[model samples]
Target: MSAPAPIPDRHGRAGRNRPGSRVWLFAVPGMTLFAAFWLLPMLRLVGVGASGPSGAMAYLAVVTNRHYLWSLVSTLLLSAAVTVVTLAISSLVGLFLQRNRFPGKSLLLAMLTFPLAFPGVVVGFMVIMLAGRQGLIGALTDKLFGESLVFAYSLAGLFLGYLYFSIPRVILTVIAAAEKLDPALEEAARSLGANPLRVFFDIVVPALTPALISSGAICFATSIGAFGTAFTLATNIDVLPMAIYNEFTSYANFAMAASLSIVLGIITWIALALARSLSGNSVPATA
Candidate 1:
């Protein structure tokens, strides 16, 4: 008897290839790209971080050393504040925009989301124009209170810059999530004699909780890593981003900068991971 014929491929080749033998070929490009773009760069960064005078101990200085630790702490606090304020304001505005219909509503929403199109540097510049020495607030305050109020080049300015970008980001996320909510749940809560506040807190807030959490995490991460705005406004302050910039540029401490960068990346990754895990899905973070 003739030997059994081999299985034919789609092209009608006489014999079939071992099913999984060449699967590794499919992964080559992906692995190569990953290694070239992500893995190799990361490994190189690690090596650089360890290339300092103190060697691998420079990474530990991020938390153990006083100056670096203070910078990290300040950045954490600032980012937390920005995230909370952004979420609070965005939640209200997003809910109102989603629930109500009024003249110019579309225009108002367009204006609100317009900042999403602005880069970090542009947002920082806008903040400066609003809070700078010659800005609108300074002019208004000078006339009203006999002082040209200026905080745009300080921590306050940094906070405002963070909020400027953060608000639009969280607003977009909140609005998207809010639109998907069921009005029936809210109406039912009210039908049972729950007051508007109760309905809001119990029904609306709960429904929007996931969005809020994820968006807040994104905002926090952005604020922590933000540099352009901080550079424009935080002339007298220090955040992690600014610290890294100073280390890299001003002091030319590449190793220290790399270590700080790694630390910042770790914290940002943790925030993103928590957001993903708690929201039960991956939430894309807008810059």
Candidate 2:
């Protein structure tokens, strides 16, 4: 039999390469980029972390050193808190926006997502303006009871900054996922005597679990590594990002900085991995 004609590609070029032939070449650039950017830097970071006077013990500083340990713990706790709060708030707002149509809906969504335009630094600045010593909240509190409500340089401020940026991304995801939800399922649940909370938990949550997991993981990772916001408002908090910055810049402790960076990246990876595993999909590592 004569050979079949080759399949024409979009460019009208005949498909000349056979499967398992030059397919591997397509991955060469990706592999090279990954190695040059990620793999090599990671290896260098590990080496630098071990090359200090403390040797491999530098990596252990996060646990053996009180300051480092507390910094890591605080970062993890703050990131977790941000993830939970962001998800909860996003869930409510996303459902409301998707399920109901109201006047100024577009305007409301635009306002809700307006924070996405602000970088971490801008968000931090906004928090300071809203809650700083001379902020409106402080002025009001001082006027009312002679006590200014100043928390813009504290962990609370950091949390608010993170939440401001995180909610836009997460709420969008929730709205997109919720768009695919089967209303009949909810109606059936309601018809079967399920209460509001029960129907929500049993019917809605499962449908949105994948999106929630992925977005929560991204939010957690962003909070964990959000250096700009932390740098701006880290006056009273010891988040790991600020600690790493101090080690690298203030003390020139390359080993400690490298170790902290490695630890932070690993923790972020773990969160993404867990989310992927739970969602049965490859969750992205970006916010």
Candidate 3:
């Protein structure tokens, strides 16, 4: 029998005769930029931390510190709450826009997404003005209820700020998913005597799970890493990002900050990975 022919390389050339041309042209600039802006800076920061006894010990100390752990726990709790609220609100809004005909629907969606255009710091300031002790809603609530409903400088403030950013993201993602869903499935459920609630729970909700997961993951990651809003609004509260900042700038402890950053990065990665995994599993495989 004749020997099997050698497999062609990427350009359909034989192994030894492959072109010497650079195949990394597309990747070269991006990799270079990434290294320059991200990877190199990260390495330098880590090196700075590793080089000093105070830095390294501070990092270890912060990681094992109960205060740091509590801050992380608080941050996660706040992030989760915000994600849940944003997901629920955005999903409902998307369903309304996609399925029901309402007046000024486009206008409403545009308004909902307007927050995405605002900087987080600006959003935080606006929220504080609206919900602070002397602000509109807070003043009204205080006058009517004889108690301040001021949410500024608290976990609630942070959550509200996160929701402001996250809701728009959720709306955009879920609306796209909603648009792709076949309305016939919903109609069939209705024809089978399924109530609106039952159809929504059994059919619509299941279909939108992947989008919800994705939006939640995005919201969670952003909330955990958020600095602007947390700095502006939640000064009284100690969230993870704020703690990291304090460790880095106020205390001048780069090692502790690095350690905290690594922890935050790990958490974000895990949440995103879980979201992707869940989305992949939920999506039906096509031929």
TM-score-best of 2 and 3: 2
Model 1 clash pairs?
none
| Runs of candidate 1 exceeding 4 Å displacement | 1-31, 282-287
**Model 1: how far is 198 from its true place, Å?**
1.1
lDDT agreement with native, every candidate: 0.89, 0.92, 0.85
In Å, residue 4's CA in model 3 sits off its true spot by 21
Query: How well does candidate 2 match the true structure, expressed as C-alpha RMSD?
Result: 5.2
For candidate 3, write residues 1-287 as lDDT tens digits: 98656657889876644343557787889999999998998788777766666756655765578999889889999898998888989999888787778788888889989998988899889888988878788889888998878888888877888888888899888889999888899999999999999999999999999889988999999999999988898658899899989988899877777778877887999999899999885456789
**Candidate 1 residue-wise lDDT, 132-238, digit = tens:** 88899999999999999988888888898888878988888888999999989988888899999999899989889989999999999988887777777766887
TM-score (all chains, Cα) for each model: 0.87, 0.91, 0.86
| Positional deviation of residue 112's Cα in model 1 after best superposition, in angstroms | 0.6
Best lDDT among the predictions, by candidate number? 2
Q: Give per-residue lDDT, candidate 1, residue 91.
A: 97
Higher TM-score: candidate 1 or 2?
2
> In candidate 3, which residue ranges exceed 4 Å CA deviation?
1-23, 54-60, 281-287
